[model samples]
Target: MDNLQLIKSQQSKYDEIIEYLKQDNSYWLDNDIWNVEDKVFGEVEYKISAKNIRFDFIKNEVLKNEVKFYLVYSLKNKYLRLSKVLNEHQFAIKYVVEYVSKCLLNKTSFNEIHIDNNKWKLFLINNGISLNKNNQIHNTTYRGICSEISSFIRDFYDDREETEKDIWYSKNIKGAKIPATGVHGVNGHINFMSIPIYYRNTVKKYFKNIITKKSWNHCHQIISHLNYFFTKFYSNGYTDGFIENLLRNDIENYLYWLGNDYKDKNPTYRCKFVSYVRTFLEYIQMAQYDKAPKKEVSFLIFQDDIPKRELNKDEVKKVKFVPEPILKQLDNNIMDLDRPQYIPIYILLRETGWRGTDILNLRYDNCLDPIWNNKEQKYNYYLCGEITKTGIAELKIPIRDKVAEMVQKSIDKAKDLSTEENNPKKYLFNTYEGKLKGKPLNKQSLLNTIKRLIEQKDIRDVNDELYHFRLHSLRHTRAKEYVEQGMGISIIQQILGHQSLQMTVHYATVTENTLYEKWKNTENLDLFRVNTETSRLEQVDLNSDDGENLIRYEYVKKNLDAVRVPFGVCFKPSKLPCKQQMNHCLTCASFCTTVENIPEYEEEIDHVKKQIEVSERCGRELWAEKNKAYLRLLKATLERVREQKIVHKNGKSREEV
Candidate 1:
């Protein structure tokens, strides 16, 4: 056994495949053919009338047997995704089988029938399967065919040495790279040979460090970035290692080439690629490792290196969400979703605005947290889940009772189907049947299912075009709704699991009407004016809207430049320029501020103190004195601003203060 290549499974493909099909007879339609019934598929759009999906095209008996074995196995286990509506999958399998039969004949068993990768390529090419990026459906079909054939050959056959030779594989790892939605994408495969042999050690060390601090998903992206980097690095035929001196021309040329190559990709893709390279360069130098670039982070990469994507008003509204009308249409037709497990997932996405991945990652045991409300005598519901993106290991955000109820239902459904091997995490949206048994529903499957619904139902947006939406658009729509509802920015920040307020701000796109209404209905403003003749501050009642107050309001708008200031607005008319410096406005008798500006006053004090220290350090004696006097004036004004709100509210006059 040790002499032979390490056995992933000792049982032959026929041993179990025949057992599952012939013995059980559940997956088999006849002795040889099979049926992928309605229950076998998810994301199905139309009526599934697929029957008699025959595999008799294979001329060789053993090869025919092998084909049935793998197909039935995959069907029973629910592993690889088949064609939509289960028709294309049939065609794919049939074509592959017919091609194999025509190419190789007279095989007693698949053990005797060894087909190399070149033959497989030739067979795919003959069927019009292309490596070109144009047709995603065709590409996906290609991926499925290769996956089924490669996996079947590798898993069942005794040709471990031969199979491993063709595609990269290790002893324990079943296969390398994940199945791409298209044939071209990869999850995690770092070809070290792609890096120059001399510089390979440095990148490997960077990866080792990365693995400890980041997920394999991140590593995959970095590997892609480096793949391009070293490809250019090698093509240049440079004598020195990996931007060793961080030459400006070298970095700029690679970036220029990268921009042209990745122009079609999301703008951030180029940014991430360059940023990742910078990180690698920094990591090597920081550790004093071999071939360290030793350059400052900004020296090689500037903020402007990555182009910013700023959508216009109409574009923002267009791309940021799927309109509610289309959403409601989707909601109504959600039960028609091909994956029944995904119904609740879709609802959660629409209602809660959580990322689809997080919704799918919801656990069965502890997903619903109901808090008892004493006054209302009801349990406030929270959907408990891990938000891995922001490193929120376990977060429970408020959910309406309906969302909670739906989550509980999904949890109940998941519990009935969970097995230790398939769903150790007990993901609520899990497959109980087929090759995906116990696995969380693929995120792509969720998206593809929705796409099927949109196309099938012909859901159109307000613009009267076919509606297309990304899953994350649901989250954005939800955030925008929250902001429009006047939900606090801080609360929205927490609900969306945003790492910073800046990200939350991006979602706070209020409609012009809402902004106007909010501005107009403000009943309180501690607005004040200056009695120019008397040189005293006089508070005005803005809500009164009397002739005097209206004139005062207009005056403030037209003269005072009173909309806002560093701490407060200048009560003195703009036409009369103050003799004092702008920063010294707080000391002016015309400075009128509200209680809300207290924090601003304190922050400015801190700023002034720091400046005073800097002035003293530079031996600017008179300048320091001037700052000290300004500091005194600032404190006095802060006190007066407080006194105006506090004392004036208590019915005190200016003389009393």
Candidate 2:
């Protein structure tokens, strides 16, 4: 069968069970059952048969007695149908045992009888009730009694073996199980059995005026009352806009109505009314395809507003440089408390630029020594932990020199604090040794401590919101300093451990002082000149102080053409003729005439002069100057060689020697 058919079949079986209980009251008396005396029993009577169950308003004679009683059986007896209870005289007879047990508990007179092995076993207890072998008496004071019963029934049915005939021909399966009690309901739906046991009785007691009349009547009246309230508040003139269109307006009106009109009612009573309305609406929607009003309506009903604020630069600076006086005042109060455990945390907040969450949760192992240039260097404090709100965000900041020294000192102090007995994971900033509480500071407590410091400083002005200087603002301050120092955006992003460049950019605040300095430095000409001259002098010392002095000078001057030199000679040779001639070389077609007529060294003179002319015109100042000196030396040497050659050619050199 489909799901609805299955549910209907189960409902019919429950109807049969109720009937069986009513019919065989004698069976219950024989069973020796007793309902709790103080609890209110359902006054509404039920009539049942094999096929149908119905309600009756008739007041039974037995129910009108001074000490009225009802049968209480474990829900595990699911095979006993209401039809059998209503029709079977055996079941009616069992009510005597139930009644007698209740009377005896209250010290009243009542009689009971039970059948054991086809023999009547008369029970004579305190008030004329007798306990039998098969009958189990449950004292109401036992903890989780209902839950245990429900569990027993569920297990009983779950273990039952099914036969083909039982599945195919039986009207309903015997010992049909209810859901598991408490949170784990059967079929993951609402537990009907448990619901009536707990919520129904409480609901009845609270809404006594409404529920005492009739079940369906009470349910309908409450539903209608809620419908009316919702309709008036949410509906517009054209359509009863209760289902979909009603939102904030409906919620506000409902809250006002409850607080004002129900002022005399207990707060719980008003709450139950609201809860009932919500549950009823949900049930109607689930069971009968009715729609609920928009969710925004309910959400807007009890809204709260909180103010948002951000810290400015001056306030941020105050947080950074918390004065010794303020710390001293805090120390005076916290001296009886542990202050040393917290000081390192404060120092880390200022130095490493970690947030409150990160700083509070820092561990000793998180401070790792980073390898600088593949060598063991000083420790780099890396915050290796999950962020409070976002999981697993690691921040690596180079420990500043002073901060590193402070951390080392803190570590030494921590070693003294850490006895052989303590667990190091407890916390670096814990006042005590091992536990999180009393010793190590908690997150909220740390925030409050910082806030207290801000107050004691008396630094807040009329407009200043001191509490805005959260630990996060310290990180922002560090990032802003780096940005002001002309650090690249991407580098700052890495330092702050931000996933996005945009987030890093938000921390970058350029101040007027930085802008003014940049403009002044860029515009100062004299300063630029001094720097240039110093650089040139360093170059001169590097090149000219060796055996390769002239060669180095030529090399240095060649490079120095592009460089600005404040105090240095620059030789620019004028296009005067070879100084031996009166005209520029280019204007003199007679330029080679002087060299050509010196026939003894004519060829060498021509070659040397050509090299000089070429080097000078090309702006090779150093090369041209060097070549001029070499040319004069070469001409003199060549003349001496020519004179010796002439002497040797005339045979006079032998006699002269």
Candidate 3:
């Protein structure tokens, strides 16, 4: 059975008990040795067409019947051969059978699995795990088996008992997996049953409300934070669970302990951990439970409690973006992308700036939309998807013609491989065949594909270091594009699906085009010192920042233009008030410009041209002429910056001066 077939099912057989459950369907366990021989004889050789799996251990008639039904349901639904099903997928079905038999001996049934069952735990003891043996089964092998069984137990309640419990699985919720609520990603089993009973009942109710609205990963993260709190409480000799009554002093002590314990790590970790705990505490306290904490949890946690990144003035908050050269390399090698379908994903990511999950899980047919652009006299495309993270749904942002065409190809390919019923969600990117068939493309798989392509294509940064692409950076890069084009901050916020204006401001303002661009125009590039008295410019000692000798390189790089002004540096002392008009400082003798202003200078020229157009439209001849003159000055300054021949307000080269 081991060598005859390729065992491709990544899921634990225990999970199959939940996911492939068909309780109502017809099948009964009458015989001990359930003979399931594969009739899968095709051109695909080496696939086992015959194998006998045993299930004689089940003495109980009822439990055996249900187990058989579960297996039958799994076989019918999953694209697995009988050999693959019985194959040792880390002790696959055989181990599950052992555990099931043990449960019956312990007086447990399939319908009722107790959390306190120690015999089941004994099968997974740390020393080494297997039934009736010590150190026979390797730790890795059995641990995985335990995880699968654990998943099965957790999801069993989800699939079999959705209507019976307060908590509901996301798949069971209507519109949960729809594009409107974001991609319904992998359904990982969550074990609320494992929590201490004192906490379990309350937490289950809390989770029920959240599970319907939020994601499985978010729920998992919340539970982990809760588990940390529970472990800490029990270790500290506080046996009272979710209903524990505590004084304000006790709350303060807990906060103190949390911060003190994690003081050495990144403050953000402590901040987020505390933040998640606070959310749970507030929920319990606000719910008006009789045994809830005496202290107001919301009041206990303050605005200052969560840490903010305290960066020095010289600190460069790294803004990641795929460089233009790297982006070009990716585009050129798009054909060579490991999964050809993923090429559209990359293009949509680069073009629409949607998150990878949304793009990958798009409903193939309904994702692309067209609107007639009367001015252009053709159709403009928009990529439609939801932003579940920020609670925005069914957002349709514009895309380029080329991106739309690439997406169309992906949809066509998806249609060819699987039908709307086969791939129920009709995802544009999905596995062609396997147990994971019709499921959304794995994000990890996409990452691996990108990694392999980078190595094969020798995708490197400006300094020839191999550039590992950050997928999230594409979102930042697109925001930069929006900002560079002068899109309103609010508009960009909506497009990026940022809930807060502050979040949008951060993305829009940082706008460091890319590290490559920064490397080109900035980096350890150069610093210029201008003699204040003589107005003669020359390269300075970067190592020394003594007044009149050099300027601090870090200070200069961090602040885009000296003092954050658009036109460039001003020689005037900080205390002095400039008599010159706003932006007219460019023409003033006190203003000093440099190569650092090259990009801004170019942008200013474009702005002036637009100003000229508006002025002309209004028939304001004098205003139009003034804009034209400003445009001329901007172009002249741009030429000097490009040539590296910048000589400030005096308009003389250093040699001439």
Q: Each candidate's root-mean-square deviation in Å?
A: 14.9, 28.7, 13.0
After superposition, candidate 3 runs with Cα above 4 Å error: 1-168, 175-187, 241-244, 260-264, 309-319, 371-380, 405-418, 429-434, 461-467, 484-488, 501-657
Full candidate order by lDDT, most accurate first:
1, 3, 2
Q: Rate the local accuracy (lDDT) of all candidates.
A: 0.64, 0.42, 0.61
Q: On residues 1-657, what C-alpha lDDT tens digit does candidate 1 reach at each position?
A: 673533334344455655655645344524555554545433444455666567666556655666666565554444433444165666776766665567755544544444554666667777677765643334566545644464455445545432232222222233222221111213323335456667866777666565534534555677777878888766777665546777777788888888888877766456777778877777777898857876775677777776664544555556576566777898799899876766877888877778777777778898888899898998899888776556666777888877787778777877877888777757777766654566577887788988988888899887787787699888888887787654789998888877899888887675555567556434223366678999999877645766466766545433312323344334554356545644555544555567888898798788667556644543445445655766777788779877766323334465477
- Give the CA lDDT, 0 to 100, for residue 449 in model 2: 65
Worst 10 residues of 2 by lDDT: 178-187
- Candidate 2 lDDT over residue span 1-657, tens digit each: 697975575455444444445533443322223231212222213543332111221123222121112213321222233334335422334333343344334422121111231122223233333354545322221222223222322322232332211111111223222111111112212112222232333323333333223232234345444544544454334243354444666556666766676676555446644655655544433443324444633354342311112344455555442233433544355423333455666667656555665666555545534435434454444434434322334556676667666666665665566643563453455455322222346555566666666566544533665534455666766676677645688987766666678667767665555567557533432222234655642222333354256445444433322211112222333442334221223123332223333563455456556555545433445445655665565565456556654222325444477
Candidate 3 pairs with clashing backbones: none
Candidate with maximal TM-score: 3
Report the candidate with higher TM-score, 1 versus 2. Answer: 1
Give the top-scoring candidate (lDDT). 1
* 1 against 3, candidate with superior TM-score: 3
Q: Which ranges of candidate 1 are over 4 A from the true structure?
A: 1-185, 188-205, 211-216, 243-246, 262-266, 294-298, 309-317, 324-343, 371-380, 409-423, 441-460, 464-470, 516-547, 551-657
Count of backbone clashes for each model?
6, 38, 0
For candidate 3, lDDT tens digit of each residue in 1-657? 653331222233334544343333322233445444323221323455435555566566544544555446444443133455456432354555566665446644444444334554565553255543443344444444434444444345343456335334455555443332232212323555446667776777777667656655677678877777776667677786433666556567677778778777666567667777778778777887655666777666776777774433333355466677787887799789877756677777878777787777688878889989998899999888767666566788887787788888887887888875568767778775654567777776677788889999999987888887778888878887777555789888878878898887766743344334446445334466678899998766655555334345344433321222344433344345544422476766677777877777777676566556544533445545655666776777678767865646556654386
Poorest stretch of ten by lDDT in candidate 1 = 176-185
